[model samples]
Target: MKFTTKWMAAYFPEYKGAADTEIPIHHIYTDTRQKTDRGLFVPLEGETFDGHSFLKSAINNGAVAAFWNKEKPIPEFVPTDFPLFLVDDTLIALQQLAHTFRTEINPKVIGVTGSNGKTTTKDFIASVLSQNYKTHKTKGNFNNHIGLPLTILSMDQTTEVLVLEMGMNHFGEIERLSFISEPDVAVITNIGESHIENLGSREGIAQAKTEILAGLKSNGKVIIDGDEPLLAPLHTREGVLSCGFDEKNKFVLSDCKMDDTGTRFTINQNINYMIQVPGNHNVKNASFAIIIGELLNMNQEHIQEGLSSIELTGMRLERITGKYGTTILNDAYNASPTSMKASIDVVKELPNFSRKILVLGDIFELGALSEMLHRSIADAISEPIDMVIAIGEEAPYIVEEMKKKELAIEAHSFKTKEEAVDILESTLSEETVILLKASRLMEFETLLEHLVEKE
Candidate 1:
């Protein structure tokens, strides 16, 4: 049982019906279509639909109690014996209940946010800490205002550490999530061009990401990317440990090396670590998790064990075997200029690929800078990259820029993935490696269906 209806009444005193009952709420849901077991239904109001209109469906699906908006008239179909906690706003009430539940459990919270790698870093921290504690973390992309609270409410009562991923596309979103989670440790992975359209500039993006500090515990430690000049101001702040490749960082990473198996790096010139993921950028991500483990008193052995066994979310540098023994790097989960370049660099460094191909697609949410940013991706392509297949409107600009360089590389542009599929399939071979990267909207993963080796 997550909580009893009697426990909820303590905080939500303005209620009707059996508020004193000991009925246990095992789930919390918003969608009435999904059947729940003794759930607390939260009817959220949006521009298109009102969840309150579907309260009857929620009750039919096993919602034993609900948080009702005081402004809305309760339906006559709701039984008098049904528990209803009247609130000014159901969304705010959901957040309040989550915050209270988090407090009651009192887990050591670690909040991770940044323009990139936040989800991967959250997984790293959770995996490492779980070696010595009962850990829970935000699942999938549930890092927004509503998702963060739901993630908190989903944790088990015995969770010793709760790692929360806080994501935002505009200002103040991170701050609100921070206040809700109240993390004991805050990690800023790195600043990048993601959501630049909404946040204005890289500086604006950095400022928005730093809002995670708003709800940090009084004595909490903040780990950040020391190499990112935008985050320099916090480098000298008390309890802030910077982790990066730069020599000046408190937890410096050096001697970085990558191979077919994984990456190896040394931190502070003494502690050696290895991770299953590729990319030098991930080395910096691993350091953040390492510091968190250290701060929480996890031993070096356990930390290394965690890093070695990380299972990343799909499409972030995932390797797949293609139809003709080709290696496909599926970094198509999402892309910003910074991340796209980083993935490209990883492709350039991998050993034994006779040919390297890049299948690039348009990046979204750049607003006025969309064209310029898409064109800039060409700067990361050079001699080692043999072929470039550009798709989507702005993505063709990358092929245009590559032409201006007058290199001997093969490059093509297509308006859609369907146009490029036959060409991409023809390039698959044992000696070739292809990297597919673009924004989430591109749905580039769909192309994998035609490329993957079938049993």
Candidate 2:
């Protein structure tokens, strides 16, 4: 339940008086506002403010241990009895400490990374593994430098499974995270145009996602989406399990059907499985977990039960009953061209017949190719969609282009989210099955909350 100065000294040799300093640990905190008894405080120094200023407040609030930068002066408020691990860089020390803790527990780690579906796939993997073992997963989007380490350190000594989601907008972020987490199995959902601004191209994204392989043992299994052109070429090798809809994939999903409740797909055509998540993407997401379950030696019944009614507090597509009997599909967790199109396809197939309305917000991080990718959503438009309400600045190109194509469906572009939400909530009818989709940065969840809200 605690990370001691004794263990930290092993990683940060610069720490002084380690033998005399008493390490007290219960929780980890970055903000002094929430500091409490036995908390290990990490002061993150950035361009704006230095964390050394908060050391006094953190100590006053009962923070017992801290990562002090050797570059800064030691605060007088720090009591003589307290433990302080001096580090050349506090953030790097945090990562090293997490790795030390991971080795201490030795949980079965599953490292997952991709342009999309990392969160969903993590949910699926954790849910399936929980069928027979104690599990802990990355909470929501806590899959970055700080979250990954916290996830590993948070695991109890008995935690049999740890599903870690690795995300990056710049290069080497995943590489650093992977070093801390030596996953027994690595899964890559797919490599897409996300983070294209920073990474440069789709091919570059593949390289960044492949960084997950850095910490993986040579004999450990690597899972990938075989249907992805970027990932397909690298599929064949020892200890690799490719999962997708393609025949070449080691695990294939076929005979897929989606209705109001869930998606049903057969794995390798040997076992039919059902999951409460919609979209063809969810089928692939669930298949990755099913493969993991098989590797863990679980029965089909366990896999089936685990997949059904899977828990994701707020992720992917979820059906909700709105006011005036309007049905809403809140895929507002996040969106990209690939996922936006996939969600549009799922909307096209929903059972209850109604006018399909799309409320889309701008997707960030696509870089120079942003406009073209934004415009690609136009190609995904078809029958069943009565209107497309485009919100945010970048998304308007797609909406305007759809107008030029004379596609004959209603399309509206708004510069602000509130303006778009105002239109949909008032102008849309009861027969509407609205789809709220956008990137996480857009805070589309706020707009989704307003439209089709059932009292």
Candidate 3:
């Protein structure tokens, strides 16, 4: 990012510094621990940690400048002539800088958001768009407020297409990110019971997710999951393209087939598509990318290559071999009731596994409906799953509900991951496929590691 020190004056006019020199800032950094060179450090204040405490470390680690909160006293460690963009809040200043940089570069931005498939869809869109354009997308799971700005600032000046993942837990969050991104094209993957605790119901969740349309460009197009009844309101909206298995969708999904390797599907019988990732849901995720690719005028061959060559973000159904010759589907990145069921459905479809084991943990943030949502996962379990190993505070309810329903699947529940591992390791075999999925707080990756290491 080539930003002049003088340019900072535009967003922060009160920025007290020499405005003559055009200093090029190569990077923008928040965490002092991460290695940075000639970067602008933006100190943020939070409840548990204060980034202002790390300013000296940031400067020592090669930060050429920083955004200084005007309310806070200037630290003495800095030289009198050092560049400090002064603002009321450093975090807001960082956002302002990113917004300014975005305007200067003026890349076509695509915003993607959903309860389950945001990361996968972002990867799909980026992979496909990058085949034809200089594309940059949200890195990892950094889709929140701070992460979104950081993503924008991190983009190269030459970037032609910018794909951003907009994530939220409550109202107004997506609206803030949408306004910040000013997306030329917006995609809402689906609205599910992700943050029912805060959003109340599926209707409320849908309301929160639709905030992406707030800052959508007047001429921008919208692609959505038409199968969702909650999204039916978007059906008649102008410039909105719907993609789903439903025939009512503009790009109808059809003839989906999946195995251990991947998924093959067709859209409207006009194009046949395949994804390296397995899941009917992932095929849905790929459908969003396909629509975006067409909107960008990318050719069919390039679009095919992009979807077929997808590399999903870590821990999202990542395949790994266990020490006992078991196949581990490490989807511990995150989980909502909807996502959990989707993962379970994918595991059910995989062929050649003699035994299918589902290691599910609690789906957090369900509010009053936590138990109900937890119990709903049991509905997805059947003969395809030989055993269900559940861990977490809410997991026992799953086992209880399954027993009540007499699902006929062997089930076990543990309050902690440590307790579950012993039984999990004992059951592993050459034909076993274990799927670990939970909320990020559960840290189920540790179980994945244990299974991978156990002989």
Candidate 4:
């Protein structure tokens, strides 16, 4: 964010005043409510509201300048001498400015995308690389079209490595992100049914995830999950690095073990590694980080140190103590059938717990196959699981399937999390370990709060 308005005018020549102004813009802001100090406000136009309306508010809040949409009328209150970059579209201008800044900084960019685990994978890669290099990564939920550009723009010029998470609900979204990033190393976590509502099927999801390759550097390397049959076509491609439990993968994860403490696994059958995060999926996530570390020429000791001291984003299988002395695995950040099963598997693996409870919720965006997909989770549940509390509109499908199986487990279905909370408040105890998981809309994390407050 060290660019000047003079530099920005080079890409966007149409400006109202003072193209040679020496204003150093250290921040790019979109939201007017946020504090904007020496910031350049880029007004984005949406279906419901136009950001152009907030230009004056942004300027009042410390924005040095703004990007004005040419289609909109200029406010008569504003002076002509005030700095404004007139563009056909403010959103496109923001992207163009971000691209220009990225080219100038010239850091080694890594783009991560998938149906699940994109955020965790990005965090893992950034943590490992930061041990040896000045690394910057996407913060918070900023991994989309606007988020990605802002992530790049937010990076320090001295950053040696940049890791960005790419998220998409439909086709071509990843392509646009990739084109902006031009990644030197692209990692596809795995193909799942996350956006099956819009993308059609697992095959369609795979195709959409592969769009990350659209802007990959000519000599870039691709790291993927070889265990997925949908990605089998990439097994033989040059510069493609595969990591998974499958033997065919170039970097195979073997001899795995997990507990409440963490997970231990071997890479390539010889190198031992441990990550603080639970679940086999997280172990696979660390494997991708290991590959990226190696490609960056980081030594094994440094990489292992990085892996052992991993800092993950919150609500991804995080083990927290409950008010009742029970354990709460707050993994309610997001859910897909694959991720929900993975989280459940982690719950089952934790030892010393007398009762393992799974408070599950709906997985969104499954299209017409939502019911069948929701029921499919039953295939993963087994013994050691004492109770299953399904929440949300589509979660009852899981309960129905569980009942049909007739397993020796208690199952209850609730239309809302509020109803589920009443049962959990009385049921949870010191020996209980409960997992809360669902899509972002379900807000399953609030249930964990209720458990903590009851005591």
Task: Give the number of the best model, judged by lDDT.
Answer: 1
The predicted structure with the larger TM-score, 1 or 2, is: 1
Candidate 2 Cα deviation (angstroms), residue 260: 1.0
Error of 3 at 394 (Å): 0.7
For model 2 the TM-score comes to: 0.95
Residues 1-455, model 2: lDDT tens digits: 56666666666766644424446477777789874887787888889987778888887887777888888877665666667788888888778888988888888889999988888899998999998999989988889998888777667778888999999888899988888999899999988788888999889999999988889976789999999988866677778899888898888889999887788889887889998877888899888899999999999999888888478757477777676677778888887788888889888877766688888889888878889999989998988888898988899988888987888899999989877766787755667788888888887777656755534
* Candidate 3 TM-score versus the reference: 0.97
TM-score of each: 0.99, 0.95, 0.97, 0.98
lDDT of 3: 0.89
> Could you give the candidate ranking by TM-score, starting with the highest?
1, 4, 3, 2
* Tens digit per residue, CA lDDT, model 4, 172-234: 999999999999999999999998999998999999999999999999999999899999998
lDDT of 1 by residue, 326-413 (tens): 9999999999999999999999988889999999999999999998998889899987999999999999999999888876889999
Best TM-score goes to which candidate?
A: 1
Report the alpha-carbon TM-score of model 4 versus the true structure. 0.98
lDDT of 3 by residue, 25-78 (tens): 789989999877678889899999888889889988988778888877888878
Each prediction's number of clashing residue pairs? 0, 0, 0, 0
Residue 187 in model 4: lDDT: 96
Off by over 4 Å in 2: 16-24, 427-430, 452-455
Q: RMSD, each candidate, Å?
A: 0.9, 1.9, 1.5, 1.3
